[model samples]
Target: MQSATSPLQTLLDLINETLSLILRTSLTVRSFAGRWQPLRTKLASLQTSVADISDSPHWAENPLLYTLLPNLLSTLQRLKALADQCNDTSFTGGKLHMQSDLDMAAASLTNQLRDLDLLLRSGVLHQSNAIVLSHPGPGSDKENLSFFIRDLFTRLQIGGVEFKKKALESLLQLLEDDDKAATLVAKEGNVAYLIHLLDFHNQPWVREQAASAVSLLAASNDESRKAVFEEGGLGPLLRLLESGTTTLKEKAAIAVEALTADPENAWAVSAYGGVSVLIESIRSGTPATQTHSVGAIRNVADVEEIKAALGEEGAVPVLLQLLLSGTITAQEKSANCLAILASTDEYFRALIIQERGLQRLMHLIQDLLSSETLEHVLRAIASLSASEPCARVLSSSTLFLIQLAEFIKQGNSILQQISVSLLSNLSISISDGNKRAISSCMGSLVKLMESPKPVGLQESASQALVSLLTVRSNRKELVRDEKSVMRLIQMLDPRNEAVSHKFPVMLISAILAGGSQGCRKRLAVAGAHPHLQKLAEMEVAGAKKALQRLSGNRLKTIFSLTWRE
Candidate 1:
């Protein structure tokens, strides 16, 4: 009793005791011979007591030492039953089952891991408890040592494919927690292994859990992402999106999400028709499936053709339906899809309104106004409104300028983008009521010019302002609004190419709006800006002269600067 206890000693005791309990159960099952003999009574007693104690919430608070020994024993009993059912003879020393050896080993390994988890969670084992637990050390700590021991032992015992799959799944149950998983993946160099499981393992859960690990690994850094894809991660995930169980589909969705995060990843998903599968998953999968599918698709929507494919895939109808009938998560998917697709051409915009998409959007708003929807309805609404065509809908007899104005006043960034978009649509020139709505939106437009922006938002604002400038009347209004002009000038640095192009024209418009003197000065400055220097010369020289000049010294300078590195 006076003896001091060591960490390794305590861990060994836990492991040995757990193994002893497992041996006792296996021995009893074997000695009884009959699957349903007196031993069945003993088994029933054990399982009931174990479940009763484990299910108590307070059990997590005060973990009893060796408490997990019973669960491990029970789980081993379960493995024995599974083995017997399958005619698996694999047992102590791997002798009982020959043909079934791998399967039996896999099942027992899975159950054993389950037992370890219970012990660690109950705090009876003072180990670095996370199965996928990360960072075994502040470089030197007691818990870290435990994790190191557990992970080391688990990896050391890797067996056949089936056995490895079960063990990996149990490890994932440990690593799903981001902190632990991040650490575990780093140490194991598991990136390549996880990618392989997506293809080699046939069981849905095994691949599903493996996908989760892969996703985590890929999300860690460029090195892991490259390791996974280099090992053929992309193709298997696309295939799973086609036919796997919902759980596997979600897992695949997550992996796809991780792989496609970097712009480089967008091409990977794009290469083998990945976009088409993701779109279909969003349109037709279960609610949970759609949530993840939409997330993956959204990650890479920056590529335009991919967005158009998403639209033509009948994605809008299903997304709209989900918004109407599914959960809050479903509504979010629907809205996000709209936001992504809103960047597409006007045909879809006309389809959205012609198909009464506008009415459904308004109805969604009314329901939230009427009951329990997420306030992000306003965000989805703004995406729709961002299409100039959607502004036409806002000006519809059924909609209101005030609501659009309110969105400009208070909607989130996505909504603000669409609101500015709707204002830009004023150039379409509709009815008397529409004109008044457009004018009302003008004031709202001025308001958004002054608000804080989300990432890439100011670009959307800039394009809307530039689009508005083309409208003769709207130009005068925008020009008169000093706040709007200043904001556009500031947005010369927008992330979008189209918006960046708008800068020159909008800058000219702003100067002209400032008066004749302002316009003349802008013209001179435009003449001086590097881009303008050539344009001024070309304009004075005509098309051929401009072309020749650009192809001369300017071309050399451009090539030398870009090619030098």
Candidate 2:
């Protein structure tokens, strides 16, 4: 038992002992003596000790410790630092001390000590019997805290609406940053109590606060989310989505978003008619509501049924419109939601393209939007690029290709990945115009193929290179580059099992297809033959073809030499 309480006990003893010393000392104005200097030093040490207590790992499990310890520690440190500064000018028995300095030290010390006295006397150390006290109870020990919780629960049920509202508000305020409180709330079955208030409370303010509290509790905690769902919280939240005041709607939407973060809860929400409610909110809710509603849809978009339902409920057009003219946050959310939906079904992808979604996305990218907003826009384009028709449309645009290549060169890793993926997909069918655009940016493509880039980016770049080499015009441009042979050889690492490995080998084969003896010699000197032999042993067709290309010239040279002899 002593071991369990050691950390808290040590902190309490330190604080109380320091406070007692300050109280017992003679803090006279301009009193610089041996005792005064040592006392200030001790106080400074205590301040440092208290700061360390707040960062301890054990406090995470004890909500009372986690929440109240930091507050107490901060106040103690502030008082100690202030007192140290005030005590800097001291009086000696035979030395002259400024009267103003003495007075100032006296005033500051007096005020700080009074504040310290109030802090200790606030009953923060007395956590037991919290239910009877008007002050918020301490949470250091959970074993005895249940008594207070049970009593609070009983009173919450028997109290009037106003009292219940205030009690719930107090509970939420107390539990805000403390996971111990959150666990106790769920363990003691108080989640249902909060939901009841949200469902039937007479005051709009009460319901809003209740929803907000539930949102916080359920945000990342699976147990609380499940409890909220099983206790029938979804229906009231859905109704709130449709008809509540904007603030209430916002809180309830957040709660709904939290609950639906889990797929089971998302299915339950849709079963209770949440899809239509969310769609309606997106169509007509305030900018805030629409923003959160789109976020909620993004969470559930991975489920096939939910994706289809959202698409059928006229969500695609509404979301595209939001992407066009809504607030920046709304635009980001709408783009992400559309990206996920388009990824699920080709029909949805086609609809987005038909609605001119691609044009809006291109505009967002070209306008140099925020990195966050651009991330979603680029993701949407990447998803839509999966469709061949969409690919052709994107490849047809010279400006889009330029912007995409620039993004790959200048954007962060995420942008590089999506842009590379989109370009690779577009490379599935390279037209003459597409070939020209890609060849124009061959330097960036070569940069992407280097060692330090992510494997996905490297693989995608290889795919684009493969498509470019297919065009005879593009091949002439690529063969002249000095890094071309070495880059192709780099992709044949034996550890890479992805079919993307075949691209570079096939590209080399194409380069050697109609080349002079010099080109084959360049590839063989780049050590392509050994890697090709290894790959051909594994029965890779491209490796086999590339090997044949490298040796075809050598065999002809030998036969011609024999014929001349």
Candidate that would win on TM-score:
2
Q: Worst ten-residue run, lDDT, model 1?
A: 57-66
- Model 1 residue 440 CA deviation (Å) reads 8.8
Model 2: per-residue lDDT, tens digit, 394-483?
Answer: 888878887887777777878877887787888766576767765755655666766445657777877776676676666667656667
Model 2 local distance difference test score: 0.68
Which regions of candidate 2 fall more than 4 Å away from where they truly are? 1-139, 144-148, 302-309, 327-329, 369-379, 386-388, 410-414, 440-460, 471-484, 492-501, 514-521, 529-540, 544-548, 551-565
**Candidate 1: segments with Cα more than 4 A from true spot:** 1-157, 160-170, 177-187, 202-205, 218-226, 304-312, 346-356, 369-392, 412-417, 427-565
TM-score of 2: 0.66
User: Which ten-residue region of model 2 has the weakest summed lDDT?
Assistant: 116-125
* Model 1: per-residue Cα lDDT at residue 388: 61
